[model samples]
Target chain A: MKKHRLLTALAVVALIGLLGVFNLTFDSYKLRILNLCGIYIILGLSMNLINGFTGLFSLGHAGFMAVGAYVSALLTMSPELKDTVFYAVPIHPFVKAMSAPFPIALLLGGIAAGIVGGVIAAPILRLKDDYLAIATLGFSEIIRVVATNLQSITNGPLGLKGIDRVVNTGWSWGLAILTVYFIKKLMDGSYGKAILAIREDEIAAEAMGVNLFRHKMYSFIIGAFFAGIGGGLLAHMLGTIDPLMFRFILTFNILLIVVLGGIGSITGTVISACVVTSMMEVLRFLEGKMDFGFFQIQGIPGMRMVVFSALLMIVILWYPRGLMGTKEFNWDYILQRKYLNIFNKKKKKKTVSEEN
Target chain B: MTILNVDNITMQFGGIKAVSDLKMEINEREIVGLIGPNGAGKTTAFNMITGVYKPTLGNVYFNDKNITGIKPHEITKLGIARTFQNIRLFKELSVLDNVLIANHLRLKSGIVASIVKTPNYKKEERHIYEKSLQLLEDVGLLDLINERADNLPYGKQRRLEIARALATEPKLLLLDEPAAGMNPQESLELMEFIREIRDKYEIAILMIEHHMQVIMGVCEKIYVLDYGITIAEGSPENIQNNPKVIEAYLGVD
Candidate 1:
């Protein structure tokens, strides 16, 4: 166990060093993709915590993300910038003069999303399975509609722009690493077991003294918190976001990341998040015109989604348990095996020598 | 002292009565067996007692406290834990984790402490881990502590359920069909294990079983249920020889 702890610490340090290298080497375009990947990691991990670990099928990521993005963007925008951006309809007086530091704004944004999640969870958590999914989907739609119609606060359909681009690889991936660490720590303890038990068998979990509603709320709220932070990061990274940007398609992308990665596996989510985010960007060309040597082909605008949908289906069919299922990857597992092999070899040599 | 009392409890699902007018009591450190033919509502009676279902009539008392209509988790927290009839182990979790989850009820650390991994929480977590290991050892699953519950053989899975229930430190443990899938020798060992647990832990045990050997071997008293009604209740010897039990098993001539 001591060796395992030391190995884990080393692994974390190595990961941080690798992130530092990526930050130093990547160009702005490449850094943008990396930043997106980091945000997706946060989004994917948070969604997995609710849908995978806690066994609650929620589809409210877009709603929570919207809350976070709007909150953070509104808070960090300067008073002058806010007025100029809401030129069609003057910005809300209360928020016009209000601005906070980047980190504080991100926190408030996450808390705002958590508060919204709690409110929605109160009534919707009672619904089970498909019904819960439908209700959360409806809630996300509601949030989008509100954001679109609330002209004074959200700048209406034109969307908020001229926001500060404070998010880079450091901020995005830094938060992602922090999010993963926090989730891992939580899952390594009794609290994590209680929630996972709910996923295994609700009745047996209840019989063993797991409070269903409380644990569900814990997973949901915490998941929302990280998701909100991810949304805030995305908004600051792009310096522009509208209600349209947080459509169900946004949540669907994160869901794809979660499902393809494996439901309850954090490492799986991290790997798949990186792969899926890059794949999405790479697939963008499929939606544009193709210039052949002789003839040019008109691109299909929605072909990217069609291909992605097909890919998701094929992946699910090929690996139903997902890339990792509920398993986690730890360096200790490999080290443990190596140690066992060495010990067995030593024992075999000792017995051979004794016989000789 | 009476550890559990089901006083005239009845459970109705729609028009059908699952358990009707059921009255049972368990004393400290006593092993009581509830036997019934298929659809005789033995599991239903267990469910009502453990707060899985609200009794349509009458009350359930745990240590003289009225606990009728309480939630299952609340009942468990109030010192009553139960294993399922079909063996409901957390299949994806390790055996150690299965028992660790059951120890959740005993944890006094708040969620913040659990998330933060404070010294108090870490200490409690280590204590729970050690205790879970001890419980698994007592159940003879120490060697497979890290194995996933789903990977265990049928007999070992049943044993895991018992270990998990014991981790909750319940005053009364309810076992439902614990010997269903076990062979004769394994069942014999299970009987001894059950008896040993009752004596060692000082917990009252109420188990529903179809295996007559297990019931007769371990239970000091037995209750026979036929069609949601108790046909006989007495010492195991008396229950075995009772005419009603024979008729309930073999049907009236």
Candidate 2:
């Protein structure tokens, strides 16, 4: 156990060193992608807590992100910028005067999203499965519509722009690490076990004294909190935001990462977030003109999506349970070389007779 | 020393009465049997006692406190726990995790404390882990602590379900069909297990079973229900001889 702890400390030090190297060496475009990867990691892990671990099919992450984005953007933007953006409709007096540091704005954004998540969850969580999915989906759309119509606060469809680019690698990765650490701690404890129980069997969980509503609320609210933080980071990074930026497709992208990574595995989420983010950039060539030695083909805008769909199909076909299924990336498996054995041999089953 | 008192509880759905005007009592550490033919509302009565269903009329009291219509988890917090008739174990979880989840109600630490790993939370977590291990040891599941619940044989799965209920530190345990699919020999062993748990845990037990051998072997008091009404309430021997119970089980010729 002591040795394990030592190894873990070393691993963390190595990770810090690697992050420092990437931050120093990477160009602006590469750095932006890396920051986006960190944000998505936060988003994917939070969504997995609700949909994958707690067994709630919540597709309302985009709504929570929009709340965070708007809250943080409004707070951090300069008063002059707000005035210029809200030319047609005057900005809310309270909101126009309010400004905070980037970090404070991010935290406030998370808290606001958490409050909204809790309020909606109180009524919507009473639903189950497909009904819950549809209700949450509807709620997300409602949030978007509200943001669009609330012209005084949100600057309507013109959106918020000229926001300060304050989010650096340190802020994004630091928050991502914190998110992973917090969720890991929660899941490794009794509370997490109770949440998993609710996912496995609600009737049994309730009978066993696991309060279904309370645990579900905890998961949903926490998930929304991190999603809000991710949104805050996104808005500040892009220096612009609008209601259209947080459409259903945004939630779908996070869901895609969670599903591809293995829904319940934190390790899977982190790895897939990085891979998918980079893959999006790498695949951008498909969306631009491709020059071959002999012939050139016209770029098909949105061709990246077709390739991604094909990739998703192939992954689902081969690994129906996702990349890691319900299993986490255990260091022991790698150390013992058991992962290689998994390909060579079928798992042995222990029958009742064998036990006897 | 009555631990559970049911006062004329009735459960009705539209025109049909699933259970009606049912009254029963269980004393401290008593092993009671609820036996009935299919669709006799035995499960519905269990649901009412455990707070899954609110009685249409009348009240359920645990330790003489009126607990009617309270949520199931609150009832559990009030020292009542139950096992489903269909064996609803958290199938993917380890046996130890299944029991630890049951111990979740007894945890004093809030979510923030647990997440932050406060000293109090760690101590409580350690205590629960040890208690879970001991509980598994008592139920003869210590050897299979790491095994997924669904991987257990049918008999062990039932035992795990009961162990999980016991881990709640419940004063009253409502088990729905503990010996549902057990063979005669397994049922005999289950009877011994039921008696042992009642003595060891010092908790009153109310079980619904069709296995007559197991019920008669373990139950000190028996209630017979037919079409949602109590037909007979007496000792096991008396219930065996009661013509109404016999008629309820095997139709009159």
Candidate 3:
């Protein structure tokens, strides 16, 4: 049953990829939107790994993403001296190879993020929910604060620019699919069960022989790795970068996606990321388009966030479980009634023979 | 052969000594009971031996290795597993998944292998699931495999905890207050279940129980403890009649 569900999920993902590829166009704006969706998918999946699967309350995802964005930008740049790859730690030859091209760069960005995540998580992951949230939130702020201050490497507050724009919609969608697939494989595995076990009860999981610290660290690192890769992809799409872009507000935006999408459900995250991404675009038109009696107001970006945060609050109040609430896609969910009949008939035959 | 030796272990909470210099040993395939009044440090001894708490002063030896301060998971991997005093099953997970998670340390695949879905990983994952199912069936919880553990009846929940601990394939099983909430009929049924599992698995059982009916019924030999000290150690009949055991349970005559 597990095998069948996994194969069908893979097939559905491949079909979506084929459809997106066939419908591809030359317009940079549409391409950019698709690419952004992919990045959000990675961010959503990464957040799911930490908060959804591992049950750690982390608000510092943007910190790891910033780390990924900076490092990946440094590695993938064309080696010009102007605020680009200067005094750069000699990235191993293989790392440059892995990240130079569009697709490999996302993976490299994720791995680099994973390394940073491991380091940050080592000291603070041991903390409980609220403490972890504070620690992770502080970590993200520290990354942004330090990035803004250090003029030598990140050009201080101005940020790195002229990064090669290699990330296209195809790469974005492909990596998004890969992220979803990899997360699917994990949440269905023995380790996934172990993590869910930890989430349900930590003391019980330990007595059951699950190494809680190991599982906790694994989930955080993986989550951070993907968050970093997502940031890297986002940087490439923009074709320009600044430390100010990855603020705490950005972290909260991703948090909104994970919470609304249903914490543990990958399918829920993909759909919600697309929906949330488009909501931002539609809300932008409200600034100048709507006329007030006394004042004509252009759509301010901050207004949209106020609305988003309110909606996020409403969703949490309404559905406390956050979408799926530990439910995984099973064969029953995927199978149509006609196909289910096939299995039912076979089971009936076995039962009849046993009675005879 | 001696599978576990609790040598002069003491457990203290602040100023309260829960178990003071308690000593016990269990050979392979033995069924021993730790019984006394409600707060006689019976569970405390089991907790110290299982690495839930570091002994105030003494050591725990399992298979000749000093396992006093090892982490709970390490102790489990070293062939010891336990159930909680108050039925601490992973409540939100399915009954089957609860056992399957317990069996994780036995799986051949590691993190990378599981994520990559290699051929070996598939085979190993299948093996672990099958083994988990078998353990559930042994505990007669196969039908409720898909149900959430917290939804189970009190008696079934206790059985599920035991099945889960068994899934770790421990050489010694420590059950703390297994029959704490059961009535007479249910408690009697649990008595049979405990003995049957011990006989079937060929594993030693060390239990901390307040129920005399279960202690007298299931244990081959028993140890009585009070104020962190062992008061009596003998066969079931001897323990039931001993002055220290009686006084500990009731009061000085």
Q: In candidate 1 chain B, what residue range of length 10 has the lowest lDDT sum?
A: B44-53
How would the candidate models be sorted by lDDT, starting from the highest?
A: 2, 1, 3
The DockQ of predicted model 2 stands at 0.82
List the DockQ of the predictions in order.
0.79, 0.82, 0.78
Overall lDDT per candidate, in order of appearance: 0.92, 0.92, 0.83
User: Native-contact fraction for each model?
Assistant: 0.89, 0.94, 0.92
iRMS per model, in Å, is 0.7, 0.8, 0.9
Chain B TM-score for each model? 0.98, 0.99, 0.96
- In model 3, which runs have C-alpha deviations exceeding 4 angstroms? A1-27, A81-99, A292-301, A329-331, A334-356
lDDT of 3 by residue, A174-274 (tens): 78888888998898899998998888889888888899889998998889898988888888878778888888888888888888888877877887898
Docking class of 1: medium
- Lowest summed lDDT across 10 adjacent residues in model 2 chain B is found at B244-253
- Top DockQ: which candidate number? 2
* Residue A209 miss distance in model 3 (angstroms): 1.6
Tens digit per residue, CA lDDT, model 3, B6-114:
8898888999999888888899999899887778887778778878898989999999999999998899999999998988888888898888898898877889999
lDDT per residue, candidate 2, B60-116, as tens digits?
998889999999999999999998888899999999999999999999999999999
